[model samples]
Target: MSEILTITTDEVVPDREAVFEHQGIPAGRAVAAEIEALCTAAMEVFRQAAAPAGVLAEISKADFATLYKGDGQNEDATPVDEIYPRAKHLALFAVTVGEEVSRRIADGFKSKDFVDACMLDSVASASAERAVEIVQQRFLERATARSPAATKGEHRRLAGVPTGETPVPQFSSRAEKILDISSTGGDRRSPVDGVLAYSPGYCGWDISGQRKLFEFLKPETVGISLGESCLMQPLKSVSGVFIIGPKAIHLFDNCYSFCGRCTTHNCRDRIRALDAGG
Candidate 1:
């Protein structure tokens, strides 16, 4: 049986207004309030998507453990306390925007500095929304892919496809070839070219190593090549090591292959270890 999963949503504080003002934008309380509303709405969608199928449960601070499985080995792995002291399911929180927000920001852009900061914030917001959407879609895909095909007059299987079977249709040879190249290990190169060339949306990098890479590329520039397919979202900048549960960690690791042309050898090793049950 699938375990019950709980999801909670909350606003990320220290309002983006300060950041906006720092960039010379006239961000008053009104702007901050709107940003918070947008974040809350996006998070609600995320929370709804994350809950176990057909189990309507209220997500709150008390139930965070159900959603965020902590790292099995160390306290640092599941530092939900540090990441979301107010609530568990939320690991990192920040305000971000969609196309609508971007247009608004663009409308407010006055000078070069203002334009630059506004653009950066817009990218960050959009990126967050994209991240949430990608994660939710992945969950849906896995659940659906694992579900068995419906047999006419057969019992409805709500738990989704069974494990250890071919749940989805076979990939074409071309797709398999792309998957193989994308899944290659031990390289820290950008996987954008491969993923964009073969699949839709940009892929994620290893969380542990991405900070440095993000610093190198900067959030504003990271998704530029992907155009409308992948949006750049800025994660809250924070320090301290954080680790998720083994399963979640494994998921994040495998996602590296989706990155298309990554050069991080460690990520490949992690994927191999997970596959081997190490």
Candidate 2:
């Protein structure tokens, strides 16, 4: 039997209080504790999935941060232009197993021997893929249901694009430099394949359109791919016509897709200012 190795975010990143404050969310020690528990529980599921594959080891938070950092020294360091400055806190979880088990897990669905041998048996016999899917679904549902003290209005102001004096340009000329190294032309790729060009703006005249655009652009606008699955499969996928509009950064993790113009008074005021200026 493989030993279960469970590691908490505390082992990798600093406490959750700092992360929450960095995002401009109200800080509560109690709430932060609850959030940490939730993260641990979510990681537990991944640990269980790795049981049959062998002992699982997760990447350290410091390493993960460097991987996603915009200007880190890592070869795959996320580009500065692609980095969502507003999203300084990233909670990432990954699993690593032995080479033999890794091959079995990868080919499990196709080969019955591998499936029966390396599949996670703790919760009914399940392939690694299915086990991962179940965990992701549960995680997302819980995250979506949780209510924070910060209102949508508050979040927008904190993450809002500057308009006074000289608005800091979100996309710098270095975007081209970043794109030269990336696969796509720095286009915002959809999580779902072939479904290019979705704008809440095109669908309606309301803030929903603006919100959709924002979510699409918030991530470090990587190139779009057709039917590309995210690190977490079934939970996240990428698709066609990647257009990184202004709002994709916030939506990347929060999954809160609501129009800033509709809900955020400050955002509405900013839009009016721009309109008047135009």
Candidate 3:
């Protein structure tokens, strides 16, 4: 079963700078009064129409194996292959700002209101991202709460573990099962202490993986759906697993065969942000 995550408009107010950047305008650039008015209007629509909500389900390490496949056998090893094995816990999640915002954006475009359509689209996109970020933070908080020591200010120091082998924060018998299932069983170095969300179609993980992910998550209860092309509907929705492991597991150079054809190296920025504790 999955848990429903409720969020408010205040939690995911679209960032003004992000909206401008999404619309191809640099942040802080002088804007015409009319454009500013349109931006304000877009924000109002987002505030009224947005219904940010999410659903997340914790999966056993065993289930993640089949869900992490690519197009075919012998496919290139993706970043997920390297990073997921080290995870102490994994949760599949999906978040969206909801369908009303999407409907309004479509209505704008249908009436040939390109400026309004673009503005609303940008705001909706930013709002959806913010919703996803909020969900991730909440999940991390719940994870921390599960660790009794973390609640008492002993987050960094494990009780009986040796100095170099300090287990990951919130380590449990479940983690031992994860270690046994993973190839890293015999290695006693503790799991890493960071949480990061990763999605399909990035870092060599095939977009086709979305089918399996959606099957397990069944985000339809939260009004998110997957398309035949493996794209999530509502266009602004984000879906993926929150991999809880060491920071080093997520570090990787984009040297895969697929990297040469890629245009956006967004993973570099994401990894850097993770390292910076963002």
Candidate 4:
């Protein structure tokens, strides 16, 4: 079952460095005063307009049987084949920075204010990503706090608006205390070491897989919608599976057919960062 994850604009605001990086402004370079001023203004607009929200559903292996293996159309081995089978826990999630930012970006373009539009676009993108990171971090804390003997059907809560039909799950005192300590940077070691999100359209997971992902997640409760091409509306939205387990499960060499033409190889950086944090 899925529950609404609490999110707020303040929590999802992108840092200046991330916003500048997304806008292709090199780090530590001498930026023009005007550019700096624009970034400040853009951030204000984003903070005012952005409505960050998300939904999370803890799932098991049987939840995605078809996605685990293809339907006979293609037989390419994907990273998830290595990751999911070994995951100690898994969840599907989606988050968005709201449509107002998208509308403002379009308005900027329509008004031929490319500079303002570009900065806001970068901020929105960064905010979307940051929201995901926040959700992932919270999930990490929850996973770490949970007792080893906790039942699979055990209910969990992430405060704020409860999304699905079910009532919000109450927090156990021990779990709540653990959450408080961990959120403040306590020194608790988690049974599960790491978590990384994998969306369709990457790592050989077909983009069309969004169909099933949406079926399970139903993120529209948070105002995100999937279109014909599996692209999410709000333009600044992200959806994917959270793979939780030891760092080893997430490791994979870039050897798929899609890898040769790929330029970024971002998965490498993500895995390395996870390892470093561990």
Residue range 88-193, candidate 2, lDDT tens digits? 2222222222223333334554566432332222112123323323323333334334522233233333334232222124422222121111223445322210
Residues 1-278, model 1: lDDT tens digits = 11122222222222345344434456453555665555444334333322111111123444333333322222233223332332112222112322343443444464444634453454344344333333333333443354432221111111121333222223222221222222324543221110000001122222333232223223332221112223233122111111222122122222323344545444444434332331
Per-residue CA lDDT of candidate 3, range 1-278, in tens? 78898889899987788888888887789888898899999999889998888999988888988787734432377777877876667899999998898999999999999999899999999888888788887876677567421211122222222334535443333323322222223554333355789888776677888888888999999889999998988877999999765454555568877778878798776765663452
TM-score of 4: 0.81
Which is the better candidate, 1 or 2, if ranked by lDDT? 1
Pitting candidate 2 against candidate 4, the one with the higher lDDT is: 4
Q: Deviation in angstroms for 261 in model 4?
A: 1.2
For all predicted structures, in order, the TM-scores are 0.22, 0.25, 0.80, 0.81
lDDT of 4 at 32: 86
| Top lDDT hit | 4
Per-residue error at 202 for model 2, in Å? Answer: 31
Q: Which of the two candidates, 1 or 4, achieves a greater TM-score against the reference?
A: 4
- lDDT of each structure? 0.29, 0.28, 0.74, 0.76
Location of the lowest summed lDDT over 10 successive residues in candidate 2: 192-201
- Span of ten consecutive residues with least summed lDDT in model 1: 191-200
Please, what are the lDDT tens digits per residue for candidate 4 over residues 155-229? 122222133323323322333222221232446444235689988778788777887888888999999999998
